[model samples]
Target chain A: MSPVVLWVGGLMLAAAAIIIVVRIERGPSMLDRTIALDMLVGVVIAALALWSAAAERTDLVNVLVVLSLVGFVGSVTLARFVAVEPEDEGRILTPEEVRAHDGRMRASLAKESKRRVGGREDAMRRAYPESEDPR
Target chain B: MSVLDWFASICFFLGCALNLIAAIGALRFPDLLSRMHAATKPQVLGLMLVMAGLAASLGSSQLTWKLTIVVLFQFMTAPVSAHMVGRSGYRTGKVREDLLVIDELTEDLDRAKSTPIPPSSS
Candidate 1:
């Protein structure tokens, strides 16, 4: 591998790392961060491969293997641990969804009140037969 | 540079480009599943390409074996890890259901949970 190709590859991997870091930092949920971290591992592996190739070093390949192992284990453990999280814990409902939910609840409550009022009117008519038999 | 060197360079550049694409997708994607999809697919492919380039450049029996090990391990682990992450994200409600066109996992889980447990053999 030429020095120029090595440097170019390194620069590209660096740029990728920067973007992945942003995702990890800004992720709204842990799983998003996990995905970012997993990608970061991949970027690191690519960087290592580039480095080993450029330097003509075989020793670093073992490091790639170890890193891959660690990345897999970390993601699997995290996934199993988080599999039972509450429905609302990691989810972020959009504003529109929240508004729609509120509207639905209000409508249901209004309907319940109307039904209750109708029942009350029927009970009142039964309690005061004279009021209903005004004929 | 020799033809092999040129080929290696091409592979390296292609791999780096793919890595960049994966990272950008990870940042720009709207939800966890999409992000996972972006993170895993291109990244693994990129790594393989870069590793192939590295192995070709090294050209020693020992280095070839080492790179082969790395590639094999990556191929085995990448999909499993991605599956784990996506599954966990879905289970934990980290994924956006609104963005999903299909959600068979939820249906399967509901069915499983609703069914009665069988007696343990132990």
Candidate 2:
């Protein structure tokens, strides 16, 4: 009914968005990121609801329902994928095999990290030659 | 807005804030099961409150009915989804038990295998 309400709602939604952003930045795994993003979507839906209330239109509620359904379905699929694995962790690989596999995985991750940093530095250097690389 | 409307909005705000708190708990918790719980319990109820508040404030019979449906469907499905995710994570060795208070699903796995329970086959 007033500008104050609008401002307050917007600020609340912004705060929620900031939480989602922080979660995205610090999430330790893909699933964690996905969950955080799902929370972000929920915040968006809440914001949408408030806007629809402000505008006095009911049509958007249907859109909200549709968006929520789609989000839920997509998230459930991801959760399922995360959930599915054969029920044993005690495979009979030899110690040497395990060590070799671990070594390869670490090497690949390191290479990929380096490649990412290198790409960033190249772009930054092209943008400003005098700037120190942030990576 | 009426005092009733304000009350509804405050309830909704509280629910949403709790849901956000749940998300924070999920993030700060040390294990997957606790996180799954934090994501599920508060959020499902929180969204229900949001739907309820909207329904109350709308003043339209049609809109209210639809909002009821949304709340109902979300209430029904949220737990099913959470359970599936938890079960799948457990099956795949994604479980972290150090933070868990119980393991009701521990026996379920053996029973599931003994009965040859295939995914989505039931």
Candidate 3:
């Protein structure tokens, strides 16, 4: 391959890698991130192939083989364990938003505990209404 | 430049173009399944083309076999990974139902849920 061809191919591959990184950052779900990551691996493989072809290096072929085999494992493992995410949970939270959410959760938990402790008879009646006196 | 070098150069360019296209699709597609369509198909084909170009440029039987192994592994694994991701995406409600025209998997899942399994005979 000529030097010009190599340069152009390298540029294109770089652009693809950049776009894939953006997708990875902006992906709304774990699976989306996984898919972008898988594509990143493909881009890396293509870049390595281009380099090997340009340099006529046979040593790098082993790296290509290993990458191809290992790339799928990350996506497969992620898919196996990925659960349903709430609407806002998929996106990254700001520090303030995280604090607010924690506060809301803690407030609800405190209220529940207070209710249970202060009104044991009411809690029991609610839990076992049928067993309570009808009158 | 000889015919073989020209062939390799063209292959390399086309493969890079395909990678660019796949990246564009992954960025612009509306949903996860569609992005997956972008990620797997063109990406795999582009890798194969790049490998072909590599093999052509090297012009050795030994290196050619190694390149072929890389392509073969990619071919075998891409679909399996895509299927797993798509299935899990669908199960987790990441797929946009309005965009689907067929949806047999959901129908089958519902049927399976409603029907009780028969007892096994000893």
Candidate 4:
């Protein structure tokens, strides 16, 4: 490959990488981030392919294979285990919003713990109705 | 430059162009599924073209086989990952229902939820 072709391809790929990074930063959801990250991996692979072709470096080919597999595993794993996120949780929160969310979460946690404590005896009785309680 | 060099150059340029397009789509698309469409389709095709160009330029049997392996792995994994991402995105409500023309998955999920599953034989 000529140096001119190499430079043009490199510049194009760099622009793509920058755009992908912006998407990764501004994505409103985890799934969007995952998708953008996947595209970023594709761009990286293309860049590596370009470099390998330009330099006739066979060693870099293995890196391409490993990157593709790793990207697939990463995105699939994230998709598989990701939970539903609240609309507001994806972006950065203001300090006030964070404080309010923290207070709300603490209240909910306290309420849940109280409910669990109150129900523990009933739960134990239900589980061992035929026998006297060991305690 | 020889004919092979020209062919490689064209393939490389087209692949780079496709990558740029995929990036733009990923940045500009409205929702997760559309972004996924951009992320997978053009990206994979562009990768294939780049690999083809790599093979053409190298013109070595050993390195060509390695490039073929990379493309094959890409072909095999892109759809599986895309499917997983899309399914999870739909389930997690990242997809815009209004944007869909026909949502068979939603309909099927609703039906599945309403109906009782048959008891399995151990």
Q: Which candidate tops TM-score? A: 3
Enumerate the candidates' DockQ scores in order: 0.51, 0.22, 0.63, 0.62
Q: Write the per-residue lDDT of candidate 3 for residues A1-135, one digit (tens) a residue.
A: 899889999999899999999998887999999999999999899899899988888899999999998889999999999999888788888899999999999999999999887688776778789885523
Residue range B5-102, candidate 3, lDDT tens digits: 99899999999989989999999999999999899755578987898889889999999998889988888888889999998998899989889899
Determine which window of 10 residues in candidate 2 chain A has minimal summed lDDT: A83-92
Ranking by lDDT: 3, 4, 1, 2
Instruction: Give candidate 1 misplaced runs (Cα > 4 Å).
Output: A83-135, B111-122
Per-residue lDDT tens digits for candidate 2, residues A14-126, read 77678767766665444555566667767776766667776777888997777566656756787767633343322345799989989999999999999998898888888
Give the poorly placed runs of model 4, Cα more than 4 Å off. Answer: A93-135, B116-122
**Preferred candidate (TM-score higher): 3 or 4:** 3
lDDT of 4 by residue, B1-122 (tens): 99999999999999998999889988888888888888876557898889889989988988888888888888888888898898888878888988889989778777777778933422
1 against 2, candidate with superior lDDT: 1
1 against 4, candidate with superior TM-score: 4
How would you encode candidate 1's per-residue C-alpha lDDT over A1-135 as one tens digit per residue?
788988888898999999999888786777777778888888888888888888877788889879876778887877778655554545556899989999999999999999998888888888887775522
Best by lDDT: 3
**Residue A70 lDDT (model 4):** 70
Per-residue lDDT of candidate 4, residues A1-135 (tens digit): 998889999999999999999998897998888888888888889899899988888899899989877778888999999899988789868899989999999999999999997799778888888878624
Candidate 2: Cα lDDT at B43? 50
TM-score-based ranking: 3, 4, 1, 2
TM-score of chain B of each: 0.85, 0.76, 0.90, 0.90
